[model samples]
Target: MTSATLHGYLEQSARRSPGTCAAVEASSGRQITYGEIDRLSSRVGDHLRRIGVRPADRVGICLPKSIASLAVLFGILKVGAAYVPVDSLAPPARNAFIFNDCGVRAIFVEASRAENLRYELARLAAEPRLLPLDWSDASSPLATYLARVEPEGGLTVEDESARPGPDSLAYVLYTSGSTGQPKGVMLTHRNGSSYVDWCSEILAPDESDRFSSHAPFHFDLSILDIFVPLKHGATVFLIGEELGKNPTRMASVIAERRLTIWYSTPSVLTLLVEHGSLDARDDHALRFILFAGEVFPVKHLRRLKAVVPRARYLNLYGPTETNVCTYYEIPQTIAEDRSAPFPIGRACSHVKARVIDANGRDVPRGQEGQLAISGAPVMLGYWNMPERTSAAFHVNSSGRWYRTGDVVIEDGDGVYTFRGRRDRMVKRRGYRIELGEIETALYRHPAISEVAAIARSEEAGVSIKVFYASRDGHALSLIDLKRFCAHNLPAYMAPDWFSHQQLLPKTSTDKIDYQHLMRME
Candidate 1:
């Protein structure tokens, strides 16, 4: 592996193995080798420069998971431009919000979404040039024009070359915020490349290993699923979003593609278990399962382990700001920890983690505190929003560190376990409690499968509103669940209102969509 510099990393890999596989589309099965990626991305850079796109300008990508997406990304960065990844899978409003907020100057979108792009561009206060991408090999009418549009009026080639700096913006990833607005996290070139380097060091996946590119492009988790394989010169089989909606279909794609690596939110795994389908396990092709985003339901983990117990199960923890700050390889003991919500293992070697009390001082061991991370993986800040950025990426009086809103505790062994969220701490019956703490207790019941704890205030008392997903039509009454919680957790943390649903609402990245759920009657 080379240095963490973005261009240096991509350039070195291109030099080392130009013929190795770089990217492949899950839907069309189109593949691009490192050599093709280099050439096309170079051409794309040249094309962008020709069109007056300069360094630091935002370049929006609205394409699907395809070779072109990878090429365009490398190309945009090659031209010293920051890329804003807008998920084609995302809602049009969300996509439009990202583009407008970031002040994108150029866009690359799939032909299927070309109309939407046109409408959005028309509606924009200022219209940026929209480039329509065709996945097919054949040239479109635009290609002829694109060929003729070389650095037009630029006058010289060397002047238009891509100029990239490690500290410069690499991407702007949008995440749903508590206020219903999408917060755009601006990650530097180093932030992304450093993560790739760290992951490549931690899990040395090689070319022979074919991985799944099922995670959506918008999510940071897609880095491992998409780029890590490319960085290692490995093949990545694409699994379409259509198939991903049906876990069985997704599992079938995994088995069919003979995927060896997977990184997804635990909710997808829960869906697999609830459907009683382990498509990949039957074939035994999957050897690695790297779950991130949210806590994994232990029941599903046990079920999955029974099928592929030998598979390396890693619980990865991080925010959109930090690609991945910590990871814990499944210990030999697969038994559920009934004590806390779930242990997120230890902080990654690249990160400095501290569990601090409200006073911003380290708490005694085993005491609950907020988890703050200081590392290269921590994002530069929110794009152009200094106040919110300052709030998130702050240095304590002692040193420089970013405070992660998550609460956690450190064990004697130095391994940290997730406690809950700081905001989740709520006042109930004159008692302050963590809703996540109560939800963790609820899921421990054998009959309960997946559960979410929401704070609801009513005349009866301040109690929790739990939405759960159970297996095989199993049900747990509100009273029974409240009793179960009372036996395990404190009275203040117990839920009085409970709703059992087959599936919980999820975000675009597939984590439990709490805001959407809050809207549910």
Candidate 2:
């Protein structure tokens, strides 16, 4: 059972603990044991092979968080292919762009979603084959496909062959691109294996522990949420998208499911503190509270710590390209002092990180600079984007480093603190959104002559505000623009507030003064 690939971890775990719970649906109370997951995923691998899914090919997975999604993920990996997860809540156009951009020839979806994607599939120049897993009708494609395939116990010509190696691509997660398109971040098994290996050492999970899966599959944080638990034979309690938005319900589900490990953005913690009624509540099952994606407000962190005083809190920091390169263990003193932002701590065991100045040399202690990470976990690069990939990384005498567009200040103690972003990307509610992407979507509207989007801190988290100019004599309303954005972008990327302006503020050089707009907020 010794294997190097990501899927092999699951196979090893299943062999070690066949009867242990692998995942559970919080809403439906449905559970999938490790034994069933392995057998079912093997069947999925066989099915995918019959459909000609080749090793190194990309396969799209658009199902919601459930036992089926987990199976489909491992199944895709079992066949030596990577799964491209598109958020089912996102607009079809966005998903279509991802599907085409990644050149995915096949997709696994729910039956209802398959019906909705009929038109989107037709729109694509090279339509991908559909495998709707939720459909139960005997005439359905999934049923028909399964009927032709032999049982798991039966021998398969394709099953005897070797699975993908550690260096092979495991998944391609698409993130908001600055040019109105989404860029797929290509990560290999080596990348994920390093992360999971590091996680096992830091956050120890056993068969008695239960994990809370709050992040969507598209987000990198989900890697730890799904794989770490599976690797250790623990149960993963899935929090659906709807429940995740309602912090009160999410808190209730956590207590009910007895989730021992909680991981999400600070915004979610803020929501739980303000709305979920977590203060003064003693839910001792939550042992590890891991927050990433954004800096948690000191006040909110203080309040959360007061409620879950015994729980160990860790602030994880990194971009999707490198899944949590650094982590800070929030000491209890932070609940009182609250003088500085939590340090991003040192690099993980598998990574080497440095703060470099504009000239690429290491920045002096206590000075601000961009973070450059070099490690096995660093992504392969943006898929099919050689120029951009080359531009994003730098080579030094030591090794190759991925230049994270994030700026930070490193202390003499080697602790890094968050400064700001070098680019237009903003983290809100665990989702990384590019302001330029929103502006580009707005610019496509016929009535919008000019547009600029900015993120402002709100009560719960960050809010997006868009300032737009209308075409001559064409009056624009917030309602209309909201509707337009809803049609094109995901809900998280949509503007929370809109302002119509005849002329946006500009710098002396005639460039849009984003700082002025941010101050106006």
Q: Model 2 over residues 34-96: C-alpha lDDT tens digits?
A: 998898888888778877788888999987887778888999998999999988877777787
TM-score of each: 0.91, 0.79
Poorly placed runs, candidate 2 (over 4 Å) = 1-3, 135-156, 159-162, 335-339, 424-521
Q: Model 1 misses residue 172 by how many Å? A: 0.7
lDDT of each candidate versus the true structure:
0.76, 0.81
TM-score of 2: 0.79
TM-score of 1: 0.91
Per-residue lDDT tens digits for candidate 1, residues 1-521, read 64544655556667879988766666656677778777777878878877778888899999866666767887888888888887796766668778888988888887678777667656766477888776555433234335656536553264544457778788889887888888899988788877888888878888888888767778888877756776777887766667677877776666677778887888887777667367345676777888988887676777777776667888999888887988888865565553343588788888888888666788899998888888787898887789998887547665567888998889997788887777778887688887766666776788777788887666876666888877655566767776777789876666667788877788878889888777776
lDDT of 2 at 249: 81
**Which candidate tops lDDT?**
2
Stretches of model 1 off by over 4 angstroms after superposition = 121-124, 135-162, 279-281, 336-341, 396-398, 458-461, 473-489
